[model samples]
Structures are given as structure tokens and as C-alpha cells.
Target: DNFLGTLGGPGITVPVVGAAFEVGIELAAGGVEVNLVVDASSEFRTTSNVIANSPAGRDDRVVVVGAHLDSVAEGPGIQDNGSGSAAILEIAIQMANQQISPRNQVRFAWWGAEEAGLLGAQHYVDQLSPRDIKDIALNLNFDMIGSPNFVRFVYDGDGSDTPLAGPNGSKNIESVFLDYFAAMSLPVEPTAFDGRSDYGPFIEVGIPAGGLFTGAEGIKTPDEAALYGGTAGDQYDPCYHLACDTFDNISLQALDEMSDAVAHSVMTFAMTTSAVNGTDKGKGLGKFKSDMEYRGSHLVK
Candidate 1:
């Protein structure tokens, strides 16, 4: 509240009302220090979602395993998505190699244009009929599974830890991952379904959804560092949305542990004989919290 400088200079301040309020505060004052840049360029484009299924026989309920395949232009997105993408694809391949037939139909999706606003996954859900939506037992989203300084995050599907929970059986889906991590003795925590990833579309239509995230732009607390072995006060992924988010940006330990959890949950639902639906099945529409908004650039909201 006590600084002003020339616009477009090395340190800009009080350039204008809107710019002043948005990015003029100093980092120490709990506001980000940033240089303002505006291209004002926009365009329309098309993209496709990539999907595949197991050759094995199908069951009545459908289990969707999804991860966004697109990345921001800054980096290759190896950890942000490559970890998740590779995790599911390997599971699909091994399912065929071992010829493991599940009790339900498993659909693997690598969604497109997620950075553009979760467009690909939303389109797929929007195209589904009522019956199609009902047939979907649940969804597993793995948006970012490997961060260099990471913490294992399972979606709080039942809202046990957050106000906005996922649809009906989301708790069951959450349980599957919890059990998997517990069995491995890995420290895990609940992450809210803030509608910032591909799962946003699935949960919006009453489809139970859950997944893992290794933290993005979220600072690691001292407690989390004590549990996960990382530098406290540092971001879980410091290179997020930047060119430095390359293969070296990933933690193989996080990838190994999280990927195992993903595989365990995916296979568990694939073969589960129990019904995941419940009374709340009819209440999923508009379940994503209305109070919070999705700010894609930071992804914390």
C-alpha cells in the first residue's frame, strides 16, 4: 500500500486502477509481484479425445479412467500429466498382455483441451444420454500424479474433509485409493474436487468421480514435509506451468507410489461385483461448490 513506479518500467506501480489492484502488490504483502503483459489475441480450434477399451468382456457398469493429455505451452507437462497418462496407458496395455477380464467395462480416456477449460471431458459427458450417464458407475481422474516435492492427495469424494463432495459412490471410489495407499503404508491426504480438472465434467452430471493429485502451486506445509520428505514452504511443483517442468521436474518416488495407487484403484473397480450407487445418485447435478471458482492458471481454487 506504499509504493508506486513508472508503467512498463523495471518495477511498475500505479499504472492504472485495474492493473494496480490486480498485480501491483508486493509478494511479502501476500500478493504476487508480476509484470503485466497482454497480447489480446484469441482464436477457435478443434481437438479430439482419445479413448480405448479392454478387449475382454464387458459388464453392465462402466468405469472411466481419465487424464488430460494436453499441457500448457510453457512445458512438456511430463509430471503434470505424463505421469497420469503413462500410468493408465500401461495398465490398459498390461490388462491385454495378461488378458485380465474385469467385471465391468473400463474406458480409458486421454482428454484434450483441458488447459483450455476442461472442454474435451465436458463434451464427452454432455453427449451422453441419461442411460449412458447412469451406466457409468464412476470416474477415476489422474490429472497430476508426480510432482518433484509432492504429497499424495486423494479426492475427498464423500466430503469428509471438505464441504463439496463428489456424487454418490464417490466415497467408495475414494475408499479404494485410501485402502491401496494404506496397505502400502504411504502417507496420504484428502484433496477436494475443486472442478479444475477433467473430472469436473463427470462430477457435474451425477457421476461419482475421484482421483489423485501431487499438489500444484500449493505450498508444502511443515507437517506435509515431515510426512512426505520435502522442503517446507516450497511449492509442490515449483516449475508448474513453466518451461522447467520437464522430465527432471518429476519425482520418481512420487510417481512410483502414486502410479501404484492408481493401478490398484483402477483394477479394483474394474472387477468389483458390488454396486457403487446410493441414494445421492440423483443429486450430482451442480454438485461442484458454487462459492469457489476455477482459476486455471494457479489451479488452487
Candidate 2:
């Protein structure tokens, strides 16, 4: 072969006896122009989204629970998103183990390439027919659920705290978390629902959505520090998007509390027969635009 490059990853096995191609890297002076050729390794790669669905006992409405199962290139992204993915996967496994059924079909999606500009989640949404889109009653997304200096950040579904709001019935989802924390005597704060995570795709097409976030690169205000007992003026996640975001970077207390709320909200929507947006159990008229701005993973603060 004239130009050769090795190709192997995860489950694929490459023969050990193959010779590595000689790398040709050329360098030239900063101002002097010269022809340069480098044998940089390259290959086309592909990834797929993981989706599990449980059929509804009677109703056809669907409640989609989603989390991104990817990390940035710079780090392991443990607290950035591993926390969210872990919480939901455990919930899914336990639900199957217990053989629990819900009135509405529950779809759990571990999205691929979310850190790559929400590609997987957006592709899933883009492929849905209008009827299919309408069949989705609501979406619950969990991202960055446990930061080291975490705050209990529930999305402002009704826009009372923030300027942005979700589609109708999103307030109900927000209320679910608020009520849960209130019952436990925990202080809560509302985070702007600006479609920063996987939920961005769902809400863009008018699907009512809401979820929990502990915190990220955003600085922890003095009031938030007082409430959550973390350092004031420090970032909610000091290791966010960094190589230091290993399991050790997570706060066990934040994970425990946020995960409980995640389960509570999931179970609440699973059993409820009520329509999220006053539509006939997801068979709404059509899709519409959300008022919030859509944000890419890398672009988010």
C-alpha cells in the first residue's frame, strides 16, 4: 500500500504483526515558504445512540429520559456528564430488575456525540415525523448532576426566576423537583433553561422538558455557597472539562441528593396519565419554536 494507517478501537482486533507506517513530518522556517507533508493518522469513525424503550400499559404517550454518554477530548469528564449518565443508567437497571411498568411508554436514551455539538440528540429529533414528535409527552434530561461544589439547580420551567421558559407543562416538571426538595427541607435554586444540554433538541421542537443540574463552570454565588455549603465565589465544578474530572472530583453528597430527585421525577412522570401540554396525550397540533436560545456543548459556560 502506498499510504497506510492503522485502524482499530474497542471491540475490533487488529493483527499485532502489522508494520507501522513511517511518519513523515516536515518543518520549515516561520517566514520561509516550503512544501511540507506529514503522515498524520486519520480515519473515519462512527458512533450510535443507545435507546431502550418500555411500552406503555395502555397509553401511547412517551416520556423520554436522556443523558449524554460522551466526554470532551481534554478529559474523562466524570463530573461534567458521567454523573448524569451513571444516575440514569442505574435507574434504568433497577426499574427493569424490579419489573416496574408505567402508564406511559418510557424511553431512555444515552446519546452519542453530545459533546460534539449535540449531534446524536439532534439527529434523533430530526428523524422523528410530526406525529412521532407529537407522541412525545415530555422529556427529562439530567446533565452534570453532581459537581464538587454543587448547588441544587432545578430548571426554571415557568421563567419565574430566569427570563427563559419551557413549553407548557414544563412548569409541572419544575414543580416536581421544587416540591421534592421542599418536602425534604432542602434549599433549591433555579438554573436557566437555555437548552444547553441534550434537552436542547427536544425543546427546540416544542416538547415540554425539564431536569436537574448541580453546577458547572458557573461561579457559585455567595448566596448559593451559603445554601449549598460550598466555597463562595468558586466554580461549581472546578474540574469541569478538565483531566482532573475523575470520580474523585465528584461530591458524594451532591450525587446522592440529586440522584434521589432524578428517580423521584422519573417515577412521577412515568405513572401520571395527565397531558403535559393540554394536547391529546402527545397527539398535539404541530411543532413550534421554543423561546430559549439553543446552545452547543462547547459553547456553554
Candidate 3:
């Protein structure tokens, strides 16, 4: 018997259970023969739910930070998302413990079913009113920040280098992270704005959005290895979506740096959306491009 599984969609089949079956071939000096047979079964269903969140005060304007909380069924998904989820949770806890207040409300979200095509984040955005959407100052997403063989990858918000770019104010958001890495004397690379994660929904609605990524199933190049000191030919996270993606799959060094960067971004935006939205002393520096279009190839991880 064979057990097959489909990831994030219908129609695709992958072997998941049962023993390997092979047909042996025997050859005489002039003749050889072999035969094989296969069978499969599948079921599909759909469900819905509300996205959960904890809101801090100062609701007139909002600074949203998010990470997906669920993982693929193939593995525990510790590094694929547990790394981002845990880091954001700690940041939220510390902010509360320190009693840090912000000019704009900070809403931390733990999105669900992201691996199933960003369902959670998209649902949240789709349900929002126009006014509600306009009130958002910006969004910062964090995903897969602890790949064992890592590269410090930031979203290409400005599209200056990559084909994808975010809304009008997104360049400013990217600058914050770029500036931080530069000050730390750390090398960084730009990941395409390919809408592979939760940030997709936010950017689709013209929200100034940016985030961090330490590569995933993508192979690291010799150039990246030279800059980041990891094996050139290996996937950034060899265990991605596999049973080995447990707590032990993470890289602490990469996690520490990324967590700090997350904290810095959260705190910076909490204090002011000036750099992000160009608002000063509660006055707008310029209007946000509500009609801004999303330009990029979608990479559905």
C-alpha cells in the first residue's frame, strides 16, 4: 500500500507512507523484463477561522508586526516558523515587561494556516474596512530567521535591485534594516518581494511592508558562502519542510542577530512611523499611494 500527501493545495501527490516496492529484473544473455503497478487515494476539505491578536493602546494609528504560527504537516516546523514566532513573542513580552508605550498602537499577530497559501493573513486583510486599512501605518513581517546555513536577507521593498517592490513608503522601511546591518558591519542581501509569506496580504493592499529572511530551500551560492561563511552548495535550510526541522535545526547565531533586528524594527516603528510614513509631529510628510500596484512574481512557498 502507498500513502500520499498533498502540500498546500489539491491535485499534487507525494509519497508519504508505506514501504518502498521495487520490481526485480533478471536478464539472460539476450532477454530482460520487468513490470510495475501503482494505486492512490485522496480527500480534500476547506475550513475557516478568525485571525487572533493582542492589541496595545494608541489605536488612532497602527504598527503591525506579524509571524505565522502554524507549520507544514511534514515536520514539527520549528525553524521554518517557530523561530519567527518565538522571536516575535519574546519581543512582545519584553515590550510589555518594560512598559514601553508607543505613539501608534502596536498589534502583534500570530497568523495561522500560512503554509496553506497565507490564508490567515489574507483573511484578516480582506475583512478590514477601508478606514481600518488606511489607519495602518506600516507592517513588518518576520519569517524563517534561523536557517542553519543562513544569509541575512531583507525584502527588496524599493524594487531598486529586485523585480518586486512594495508601496510608496516601503523604501524607507527597507532603509531601517539596511542601516542597522550596515552599522553592525554585517553583510546583507535582498530577497525578492515575491509574496511567499504573510507580508503578501499587507503589501497587496499598499501597506508599506518589509521583513527579514534567512534563505530557505534555495541553495546558497559560492558568493553567498564567501560572504556568510556557510557551505556553498547546500540549501540554506536543508531540513526545510522535513522531519529534521525540529528545535535542533536552528542556528543560534543567526537567531540572535535576527531577533535583535526584529526588536530594533519594532521599537523604532512603535516610537514613530516618521521614517516609514514620513509623518512628523503627527503631520503627514506626504500622502501614501493608496493606488500603488504590487509588481512581482508570486513565490508560494
Candidate 4:
């Protein structure tokens, strides 16, 4: 008899559970080889949500800000994405409270099924018409911004340090955060545009996308600790994807700073996407890259 384990559906490559004892025995026998079998016979379903939002008059030019709202089965997911969801929700409320209007329409989205894959976002992008797609000025994504042992990580939109680069204007979007951090005298570092989050869908269709992440499963280094004031030789979020990712898993300081930055970017782009997409009615793209490259210099020794 074979023990069966449930998988999270398509795109789930990692094993949910495995027998270490069996593997150990196989490994002990030098010439032993192992054959693993997977039974992924299950039903798949697609679910939808009520995408709540407040629209602007300039519907032709839309600026989308999104965050995933779901958590892993194990925990509350407060830090993994609850931090991001809460931040955007508050920003939207404040925007409404202030009654501030913008040159471009700002649409805030709380995506579903982001943990399984970028399904919610991908479905949204697929449903838009070509004209509607063209109307989108840019996308801003926020994920895992309140990791306990955090670092200020901005997405590398210019592809200077990462293999993945967003469509034109992404570099400029990146510059927005970099400029904000520089102005605040906050130390910031570049995270790769690896499409590991909700932004992946928007960028796939050539939409300019950029966002912020504090940290995740990646370990913190001595250099990062020196720059960001956290313990070295520790995972950015020790409770990542685990049941321990409760309310206490968050860093209050990290959440506050990232929320402020989120508001700054939303307000800035709302007034003028000229710095992002371009001033020429979205015909031109900004090519400027921020001048902060400390790549390998910040890694653990």
C-alpha cells in the first residue's frame, strides 16, 4: 500500500511531505536507486471574487495597485501577505478620506489564490480587451513587506542586476521607490524581477510593474544586518509559510515604513504618470536607472 498526500494543484512542484527514513535507507546503500511515484489525480476549480474599488474620471489611464489576500493552509499569513493587504486597504481608505483626485485612475485590488499561483491576476489580465489593456498605465505589487528580520528590498525593474526586467517604464517605476528611499535616507537594496509574485501577470503583458518586499525565505547576511539592523545568519522570516506566521510574525517598524512608502508611490503616480509611462500620452518610456548598486557587496561573507 502507498501513502497518498494531497498536493496544492498545478504549479506546485515541491513535495508537501516525504519519508526521510526511507530516503536515508536508500542513501545508505551506495548502489541503491529510488523511483518515486506521484498520483496527482484531482479536480481543479476556478473561483472568483468581488473586486471592490473606487474609480477615477481618467479611466483611460489606470494605475493598478494589488496585493494577495489569501494565506497558506498552515497559518494566518499575517506577514507573508496580510501585511501587504492591510497596508493597501488603509491607503485606499485614506485616499477616500482625503478626497484626493488624480490624473490617472487608481484601482486597488485584493487578489485571491495568489498562493496557489498568480491565478487571480492572470484571470484579470486575460479578461481585458486590447484597448482596455492599453489603458493600464502601470502596476504596483506589494508582498511580504513586514518580515520579522526585514530589509528594504525594491524590485530591480531595469534588469541591471536580475535576469527578469519589466516592460518599458518599469525602470522609472523602480526609480520612484529608489528616489523616495534616498530622500528619506533609508537604506534600500534591489530584489530580482523573477516574477515570483502577483506582478508576474501584469509584466507578462508588457505592463510596467514595480513594488516592494521586506524579505522572505532568504537568509539575512552580516552585511544586510549592518545596513538594516537585524540579526545576521537568520532567515528574513523564520515563520514563512508556517503556522507560526501569526500576527506576531510581523515587524511593526517594517510595516509602518513600507505603508508610508506605498502611500507615497500611489499619490505620486496618481498625480502624474509622466515619470512612469511618459509625458507624451504614454508614447515614451523612462530609461533612467537609479544609481545604487551594492549587489555582491551586501552578501554574507
Candidate 5:
């Protein structure tokens, strides 16, 4: 079955969690909370499931940090998503260890069926109400962040074309990344938002989105290689969608750097989101408070 109709579909990871909660409540009413239960009918019936962790903030606002868990049929997808997923897990664990309570709630989601086209992310977005969505400040999607041979690039979600505009005077999410890249002196190619990965859902609903991709599918031209440090004639990530995308295809140094960068960005945003371009002060709380003045006002005749 062509499950998702279009490119991306729901991996059903969270939905399965929701279902498990339903089943657990039903079963536990008899007074025994089973430690290990299996549900063959659940959408995420795979041996592997994305583990999610949430740090609730004081105001009930949320910021999402995401990576995909499942691999493609063609390859193990270690570099494609495994690296990103591991990074998210590490960041979550670090934050928890630090006991740093963020100003906004932070959610780490590991999506499934992304290669089948961004499914897990799509389903989660589809289930939210406008009010529910407004509580989301922005989504940081890490699809492919580690490749032994690749060029690092951040999403230019707001670049010309359709323009990555958002509701309620949302900030420009892309700038934060650009600034980070510039600070690091890394040669970055801004990948346009092409509805290619999980960031699709956030873009569709006017949520400011940004992410890092260590090149996949695209080739690195001589010019790009000269700017970055890869072979000019080779594909950006030669193993992309191929069976060679295993652990050996990744770089420990690259993974460590990217993971640290991701952690910095996540922590920075969680602590003081008021400075981020695409985030609105009220979006985190789902309401416009009387005291928070609107930066842009209309001309009332």
C-alpha cells in the first residue's frame, strides 16, 4: 500500500504510544500495571521504537527537537538518521542531567518511516489544533547530520521563493542557524525548504523551521568542494539511499561536532527564546497577554 499518498507519511510512533496508553488504562483497571506488554496491531510494531522525552516548562509552552529513528530499506541509515537520533538522545539526556528547566517545554521526538516520507512528523502535526500548534515556538529537525564524506548545510527555510513566513509575527527561524554557521566559520550551503523531510509539516502550518543536513542526494561541485572540504567530483553523500549507509560511513568527529552544535542551539533556544527570530512570545503560551505589546501595529483610521 502506498501508505502516505504523497511523499511523506506518518511513522505512527507517537500514535502507537497514545494507543498503548489507551490499552494500558483499560488493562490496568484490573489493578496490575504490566511491565512489558506487546501489541501486534500497533502502528509502530517494529522491534525499534522512537523514545520521546519531555521537559515541561512553567508556562506550558513547547519547543520541539526532532530526529528520525527508522532506517531505509536500502541501508542501515546510520548516517542518514542514526547520527541525528543519537544526537537528540544525547542532548535530552544531558539536559536532564543538568536539571536545567527551560523557559519553554522541550520535546524530543524520534520519528519513524521518514524515508517512506516523513510520516511520524506528519501525523503528529495533523493531530494538533490551532491552539495546540500555537504553543509550539519552532521545530528543529535534524535529518542527516553525520557523513564521513559530506558538506554541512543548514536550511534556508525563509529564502525567497515561497518565503518561510509564519503567523502572529513569528520570527525568522533561519537566521539563527545562519548566524551560528557564520560564527563557526563553516562553509554552509543553504538548502531550500523542498518538502523533502520531516520539516514539511511545520512549514505547511506556518511554524518557523530550521535544520542541519550533512548533504544527501545532491552532488558537490568543484566550487562547493573548494568552499567546503570534500571531493569536487563526488556526490554530496555518495552513500545516500544506498546500502552502504552504515556506522562505518559516519565520522565520529563530525558526529561529535554536530551533536555539540545541536545541543548548544537547543539549550540556547530553550533558555532565552525571546531573541530567536521566528518565535512569538505568546505562541508558547497560546494566548496574547494584555501587557505584551505587539511589535507591529496597524493603522486604525
Candidate 6:
């Protein structure tokens, strides 16, 4: 859809590392720094992973938008994560296209072997020095976003009964969805982290993490169906983990709308990351403040 491309760019082919390197070069030239942090001992034994970064400010603090590039043995993983990986890629493209800069660095990660117990993410986080991990502001993960017969859910890492928190001390990093949903009057739902995806690694360390899911191996509840207009008692997303989970299984409407949410969240988080962390005053803040004041004065005038 044209809107999809505009809001989140068209889906690109996501091969392993060779393709990653080609794209990384463009990002480097665009004023965004790029890198690859590999875990040699990872179950996948592949290090073709790509980490693209754009600094909102000069602080080393980062806000991550991540999705796994590897697929499960089941099928091509189009909806499983093709949707997610593509959505994040579109977010990155749009960020570059709009020239929107935020207060903290925004890192886009394409993980590997997520289906094999979140190994790629765990490995990446494990490699982070204690200090590097501390510099992280939050992680926004996207997985399985293209299911047609699915309910939209956000990860509640702390389980606070609030869509914004999960059971542990971890905050509901997914609350950003509520903001965007409210703005667009879209109905939103909350789902617990339950150690289901890449966000698990982040939650393990108390770093807030959140992301969206259409649905997976679980069945849909009558209540969910009523709210979202799908058959209750059926698999939330029947095509999950099957070779049939092709691009056709996706709802273009869902993809178009959700991709917008992804882009907005990434951009919003990037810009407000410093404010949220009380570090907006770090180098980038002065320019941000000046921009805000200039805009504020224009409104007043």
C-alpha cells in the first residue's frame, strides 16, 4: 500500500549479513553510525547481524528498536517476523527520510535465532559491558505483526495489571502504544512478556522493554474476538509456525496502521528519550530546547 510505504516504507528483502552490510554503508553516510556485534558462541554460529544507529543527541544512551532477521524452521516467517523486521526497517528508512533526530541514540537491531530460545538477543546483551547496558534507556521489540486474525498486544514486562507494567519491577515499555492508539482512537490490548520474544533479554536485566504482536501459538478468547471481530476459540493466528504463514496471511490494514504506530513510537521515543531519562540537557538538549522554544514562540506570535 502507498500509505505503508509512506508511513513505514516498502518491505525489503532481509537476507542474513551480506545484505546487512550493503545497507549499513548507506546508514553510515547518512550521519548514522552502524556496527555489528557478533557472538561467536551463539547457537546460530552466524554473525551477519546488523546494528544501525542514529544519535538523537550526543549521549551514549540508546533506545533500541529491534526485530529478529532469522526465521523459524517452520516457514519463511513472513508474518512471524517478516512483518516485524520490515516494520522496523521502514521505521529506520522513515527516520532517515524525515531527518528527525531525537535526544538519545536509536539503534535498529536485526537479531538471529530468536526462535531458538532468544539466543541472539541474549548473546548481544551478554556481550554488553555492565556500563554499556546501563547506558541503555529502553528496548522496543517487534515480532509477529502481520497476522490477519489477531489481536494487537503490547508487552507488560512488570505485570502490574496495568498495560504499562509487568510482574517484575520492569515497566511496561509498551505503553507508548496506548499513546499512539489514543491519538488515533485505535483499540489497544495488553499482553504479558512471558519470556516469549527477544525482549526477554532486556526484561531479565530490569531495562524496560515492550513491543507489539498480532498473535501466535495461543488461541483467541471470546472476549478478544468480541473486541477485535475475529472468531473466538480459534488460534489467535492460525498460520503461526507453519509454512502457510506467508505475506497473504497478513492484513494490509493492520500492517499499514501498525507500521505507523511503530514509526511514531520510535520517533517519539528517540526525541523524548532524554527527557524521560532526565538527560535531555546533555548536548542535544540545547538544540532541542532552542527548537522547541522557537516553535513555541511561533505559536504564540
Provide the TM-score for each candidate, comma-separated. 0.81, 0.78, 0.78, 0.82, 0.72, 0.73
Segments in model 3 whose C-alpha atoms lie over 4 Å from true places: 1-57, 273-275, 279-301
Model 4 Cα lDDT, one tens digit per residue, 153-254: 999887777776678888888888887888678999989888789999888888899999998889999999999988899999999988899999999999
What lDDT tens digits, residue by residue, belong to model 3 across residues 83-136? 999998988788778676666678888888788788989998999899988888
Best of the two (3, 5) by lDDT: 3
The alpha-carbon deviation from the true structure for residue 83 of candidate 2, after best TM-score superposition, in angstroms, is: 0.7
Sliding window of 10 residues with minimal summed lDDT for model 1: 290-299
Best by TM-score: 4
Candidate 4 regions off by >4 Å? 1-41, 273-275, 279-301
Name the TM-score of candidate 4. Answer: 0.82
Which candidate model has the greater TM-score, 2 or 5?
2
Residue-level error in angstroms, candidate 4, position 209: 0.3
Query: By lDDT, is 1 or 3 better?
Result: 1
C-alpha-based local distance difference test score of model 3:
0.77
Error of 1 at 191 (Å): 0.6
lDDT of 6 at 5: 12
Model 2 residue 156 distance off true place after TM-score fit, in angstroms: 0.7
Q: How would you encode candidate 6's per-residue C-alpha lDDT over 24-133 as one tens digit per residue?
A: 57876897666765332212245445789885654466888899987766688888889999999987887788686766789999998787678789999988888887
Worst 10 residues of 6 by lDDT: 1-10
lDDT of 2 at 289: 25
Stretch of 10 with least lDDT, candidate 4: 292-301
Pairs with steric clashes in candidate 4: none
